[model samples]
Target: MRATVAGTAVTLTAGALLTAAMTTATASPPATATTPPGTTASQPVLVDCLWQRTVRPIDFVLACGDGNSRLTGLHWEQWSPDKATAVGVNMVNDCKPYCAAGKFHSYRVTVRLEGTEPWKKHPGVQRYTRMSITYADARPDGFKQVMTYPLWG
Candidate 1:
């Protein structure tokens, strides 16, 4: 009977100690750094799958840049608040006869997006400053192109 009581007391004391430790650990939230006055805080920009359409004419249409490429999928392999590595598939048309009755092809591409800019025409909004694309596999004949912002609008 004495041994049983002692064992019970030890268990209760250990339980009480654990509860007290947990209480003290979470009693207050961690401190955060304050932002300085007149300085803009860096904001994270999430990459959107349909960002292609939003930029239009300036952003290449995946289809051989003949305006026949349709983005089938965009998978983000790695991403942070402001930068990303992504893979995408562009369903392209060979554009025989100006894209009429053209053969459709699938092109695999890897993309990198970086740099941040305050969106023109909109203060306080952020956008990617640069985007680059590389063909993961062989590209269609003479389809190599470089991207420039505000592309041929």
Candidate 2:
């Protein structure tokens, strides 16, 4: 419990820095480009599997089919038109024998969202198309520290 709480703070702090860097690099993006129906952020967003437009979402489900992999306790590092990044913990179920019998585990990870395309469902909203995760420590068995996946629209 203590570790999880501490990790949230670290994630938020890093996200603030990333936002600052993105602001400096992008130099004031168009005021309304990122705004859709509910919010007023100028940077692009990641469309979660549920089809929600999100900026700096606290958590994201990586596996839509089984919910086996997920990123939790996210802190956005930077959010720009071209890219969005965060530091978070990835929780995965290692189904030693089977998913039903699998135990869940958590690992520190750095997540990056990239690419941009107009969302097909919603007008005036752009979504990130790619995602990459790099484990910070203690990755699950038989996996590399880094992995990338194509985010669903």
Candidate 3:
């Protein structure tokens, strides 16, 4: 998956690059082709910049290259194979003069992760391919209160 990161159009395949670096994600149990669909539930994943699957993460970085944008205080409302919802705070840096001297601001957001596909780095694992952010109030400048983005696979 590839999408805009912190208003910058960027594509990342973190899982492919650093598959063995981190192992903190809570992946679903391995599922084989013969496994019954309803017998077991396979939850999707949210991969972080370090190529780690971030399972119901409380804090997620939106800008992987820099610490400019991120989500914090996430309280998951639902977590399933195809969709996940959460309420959190989006923290964005106001790069007025420059990025180096920017100030960070917070915005309330409701997050939704949708779509599922095989995680190439981790077999038998799936990952959310799309992300939508619905801001409650005081959204960032030049951005919509609500927006959807694609996730890296």
Candidate 4:
């Protein structure tokens, strides 16, 4: 009878320990995830720059900003790999308004680098480019302007 009572006590102690462990495991708080501040969920404008290795011909397309607004001008500068100076520049100023917002008097500048130079080198990269755009308007309050959207890709 004494042995039976001792065995029952041991069994009850083991069961209590197992129940405590399971309760503690389920009661613990879950991990929380967070995102960086000042980051937005808006979609970015799309632009592409194409370069030919043998021909050294650089071609680009400006497909940024809202389509409702017109682009008045586009400027591009090709920089050497070192980024010390510009090798080529092209500017176009023939854009008409597509919407009722009137002609979007704006200038956009884009820079693209192809191949390697004495100062810099890029390998296995199809296109390396940067772009900037600015808007203008003749308003009595002043020239209403908006800068280019920042993109890091």
Candidate 5:
């Protein structure tokens, strides 16, 4: 899939790059706080990002209002009725310029979504029970010891 990643036009192809040297994220709930209110029974609800950079030199940040980390692009490589696997890029904040103005650097990541549970806030709505993020590429600076970030925060 060809999409914009940090303003860089990066193609996420399913192959060795996705299967090799991958970091599987731990199981966790979805970002409930970020999930919009009065959500219906929507299949694959897309999370809205605060910002997305151009893909020329690869510079974009997708702030889903989670406030933990931003991402570039997420493309589902394999998805089924039971589970889904996706490949994307995350830009961890580097407290540069200032904490609020921190810049986000790119890192390849693999995300998995599985398990379904009813949405407590809204009845008749189901959301992913667990979402995981594994470092698919080299770890960014300041994240040497960390491999995955909580799917929900």
Candidate 6:
């Protein structure tokens, strides 16, 4: 009986000490840095474009400009609400060799939305909405360039 009580007391004492040590170690320091007066976080610019009948279901070819020359044959993906997982290929014919330290290239994509009878009543009638493109070198876990484009009248 005495041995069992001593063991229980030792275990309880160890647990109490561990709890106290964790509480002290996990305590956070008070805030120190403050933004200057009248400063605020900048907001991202939203890109919205009007949808035209002819613009529906279109293809875009993008060029990679190295501040002077245009590089062709670069590939990219277009994401939209109409087709959630559509992959469009680039049809660039003349492309220079891939350069590591050149200016980043800009791409254009063509999107197509099938016309629906009920779509006419919709304000934007967005057959598709471009979401984002994941660069080839992007981390597989959770890295991608994501943006939303809203269609407006």
- TM-score computed on alpha carbons, candidate 2: 0.71
lDDT of 4 by residue, 1-153 (tens): 999999999999999999999999888652111111332212111223222221122333343343433232223242333321122223332244424434443333333333332211223322233333333322212323423332222
Which residue pairs come into collision in candidate 2?
15-76, 18-77, 18-78
lDDT of 3: 0.80
**Top TM-score model:** 3
**Total colliding residue pairs, candidate 1:** 2
Model 3 per-residue lDDT tens digits across residues 1-153: 234563343223555445544443325432232233543337777876666776678888888998899999999999888699999999999997998899999999999999999888877878888999999989988889778888887
Q: Tell me the TM-score of each prediction against the true structure.
A: 0.50, 0.71, 0.72, 0.25, 0.49, 0.25
How accurate locally, in lDDT, is each candidate?
0.55, 0.84, 0.80, 0.34, 0.50, 0.35
lDDT of 5 by residue, 72-137 (tens): 577777544355677778777776776588776778887666675544444454445555667866
Worst 10 residues of 2 by lDDT: 29-38
> Model 1, range 1-153, lDDT digits (tens) per residue?
999999999999999999999999888542222222332345424223333213111133433335676555677665443665677765777777667888988878776667766654344545566666667786766767533222111
Clashes of 2: 3
Q: After superposition, how far is residue 70 of candidate 2 from its true place, in Å?
A: 0.7
Better of 2 and 4 by lDDT: 2
What's the residue-level lDDT of 146 in candidate 1?
A: 35
Ranking by TM-score: 3, 2, 1, 5, 4, 6
Off by over 4 Å in 5: 1-68, 141-153
**Model 6 off-target regions past 4 Å?**
1-50, 54-84, 88-126, 138-144
Which candidate number maximizes lDDT?
2
Candidate 2 stretches greater than 4 Å from native: 1-42
**Shift in Å, residue 17, candidate 2:** 46
lDDT value, candidate 1, whole model: 0.55
